[model samples]
Target: MKAAFLIPLLAALWPAHAPAEGVAGDFDYYVLSLGWQPGWCRATGDRRDARDCNPGSGRDFVVHGLWPQHERGWPDHCATDERDPSRRDTQAMADLMAPGLALYQWRKHGRCSGLSAAGYYAALREAAEAVRIPAPFDDLPRDITLPPAVVEDAFIEANPGLTPDGITVTCKEGALAEVRICLTRDLEPRPCAPDARRDCSRSRVLMEKIR
Candidate 1:
């Protein structure tokens, strides 16, 4: 009877197991994040070294990542049997994203997609190509301060099938940071999950000029 009581006390003192992260290939949709290059460079002070921030780089909105999302939460750094991307593979994506970012995305979000590194990058490219960048953002001759909603509206107006519910504009340090658009597994526009639909509430966010 004493041993039984001791066993119960020990069990009660043991820590509870943390919830497991989502498994590979088990997410609801995708979030294609496009980073505003100038804003990112300004906010993070990466202009001195980042190739994407270099003058004459001509980069405006670059593919940040294509992430697997749940209806409620998201997943990251999932375990996968697929091999990590090689330098050649990451370098091939330099036109769209920095090589380091390409490799990191493959490790974090891509691993959850249950695709090989090659297949994941291919899908990322396909998803990015499907979205149209509003022409106005192409050449911002001067810094502009506008409501975040205006940016979202521009994207919605440019992409026929995309609605406000399918896209969100995020800001960092009162500057436009990223434009995240939800897409189906097939890369079609879709409504974002409630948790993923949070937009930047800033009244007027700065948009740095293209470098």
Candidate 2:
């Protein structure tokens, strides 16, 4: 009985490739840099003027957030990245930063060397947990119909672990679906989510329909 349960348990907890070590932390920092200040800037609001609200276009992605919805990408800047980073190269963000923007980086975690904990981490954890199986699909409402991107993000949020190195989406247990997502450099920190996650409410209806 234990073996039977353990098999599915392992499957539920497992990732296809296990991200590189130490790089998980690095990838996490990358996520942090993005969530705080996303790099992608597409022209939003006022087509007549078509002014850049975030101005992510042509820039490397920097911020992403699930709070105001992850779709907005990075608008808020971290307290540390704003002040310092592991290596200082103004060329990377000359257009974004001012002549004297405070710059700081933790080097390992993209945080400053020493500063009080901000609990801002509470959000990034979502990205970490999204990379797992049997995540919180039933909790979200089915009526909402979350997009694949949102569902994938949720899986990583629910079950975070050792990210892997390879990147591909093939048919697994369910023959459900697949979508290409931008992966990390070496699959450290194992950013992965389950094959399927729907608005919990919608999944419930699906279950009913199946029944």
Number of the top-ranking candidate, with TM-score as the measure: 1
Note the Cα lDDT for every prediction shown: 0.88, 0.29
* TM-score of model 1 (CA atoms): 0.88
| lDDT, residue 141, model 1 | 78
Q: Candidate 2 on 1-211: residue-level lDDT in tens?
A: 6998999999777753333223211222223222111101111223433223233332222223211102112113223433343223423433443212222222223332122223223333334334443334433222232333453454345534422221222222222123223333222342323321121222211110000
Q: Tell me the spans in candidate 2 whose CA falls farther than 4 Å from its real position.
A: 1-88, 94-145, 148-187, 191-211
Best by lDDT: 1
> TM-score of predicted model 2?
0.23
- Candidate 2 lDDT score at position 208: 8
The 10-residue segment of model 1 with minimum total lDDT is 13-22
